[model samples]
Target: MNASFSSSSSSKGMMDHGDQPHVLAVDDNLIDRKIVEKLLKNSACKVTTAENGLRALEYLGLGDDQNNTSNVSGLKVNLIITDYCMPGMTGYELLKKIKESSVMKEVPVVIMSSENIPTRINKCLEEGAKMFMLKPIKQSDVKELRCQLMKYGS
Candidate 1:
């Protein structure tokens, strides 16, 4: 699978929110990924995207290299928003990986899904997810997202 990475720098008409929060959004669906990228950018966030959990890990500088804290672009990721269900890795699994890693543990992670399974939500939260959002995320959700980023963006 070809994983595409996009950032606010590559887009047109994106506002320059100076020193804005940087977010990494991961999802398998193209439409869903685009929606996340657009919404975060609209909210004045510097957004980046990956098509899967593994690609997201790569972007987070957690690949074969031992220095997982160093991102490829050298951008400090403030928060991570990921889809709950995906082909290779579930959001819960991704959350666990992030929380386990010493370098990436401080970064906040949020999970999104169309399914509102209480068990799934609880599992994600237990695994260190900062928040769980329902699918078709709206503009109203951006406020909470901003809050999470601010709380952990340091």
Candidate 2:
């Protein structure tokens, strides 16, 4: 846990927790984003968020359809957490974009949503989502995130 980035619920909700590895969260809901932020705060991990997949790609300097730009500097995002449904691009679409991206294919993604449909779950897995957590943002989810950090921190 080193750096943290958060976007404000009301006004873009941007927070910079320094240069640590980041967990990019893409969720349109303010409360959900806040909960994730609080949970990761304890671990001191840097967090960045986007309301949609497009914005997330911009933050990472990725082009349309998840293509990465080699000119960008210091854009090393570790994990991504997104909600399934959104106004513009769905989480699955975002995941697809990430997977298609040149250098981002290896980045792990976690899908968090209220939808429990098997189709959605299977779709996320097919798109390479590393984990799926049903919402309303439980403490266990936080613990799981911590475990993931531990497992991948090396």
Candidate 3:
């Protein structure tokens, strides 16, 4: 996978988040990624982005199976937010991978989708997603997420 492996421009480097939360925001859509990054940064979160699930997995030092994700290392984000309807791997699939990871199992994950299918939402929530948000993720949503994260300590 062609992982871009880059942090936000606002970041000085990998460990420069100070006391702020670091978030990994993944989306295949460029505009959506940028908007999420901007929103997270606005919420005082240091952001890193990935183009898709494979790239996000690579950035997390993970891959297709539990064994592949068993030894994750470096750039650990406090939270992960991914688009549910991505081309290669849906956010639900990505969520399973994250949940399977021993190193990343506790990291809070949020799935966003343009479609509000109850089955899909239930599946994500059942698989351990912290939240399932509708797409066009708003400033208010990010704000609420920040509050939730602070409250839950993820």
lDDT of the candidates, in the order given = 0.85, 0.73, 0.84
Could you give candidate 1's per-residue lDDT for residues 87-153 as a string of tens digits? 9888888889889888889899999999999999999998889899999988778778997777774
| Residue-level lDDT tens digits of model 2 in 1-154 | 6222343222334544343446788888878887787676555556667777777777767745334574143646778889989888898988898798777787888898897999889889987998888988777787787678557751
Off by over 4 Å in 3: 1-3, 9-15, 64-73
What's the TM-score of each model vs. the native? 0.89, 0.79, 0.87
In candidate 3 the C-alpha lDDT for residue 99 amounts to: 93
**Model 1: which residue pairs collide?**
none
Q: Report the C-alpha lDDT of model 3 over 30-87, residue by residue, as the tens digit.
A: 9999899999888888888898998888778686554564334354588999999899
Alpha-carbon deviation at 151 in model 1, angstroms? 2.2
Decoy 1 TM-score against native: 0.89
Model 1: lDDT to the true structure: 0.85
Where is model 2 more than 4 Å wrong at Cα? 1-21, 64-73
The clash tally of candidate 3 reads: 0
Q: Estimate the Cα RMSD of every predicted model relative to the unseen true structure.
A: 2.5, 6.1, 2.8
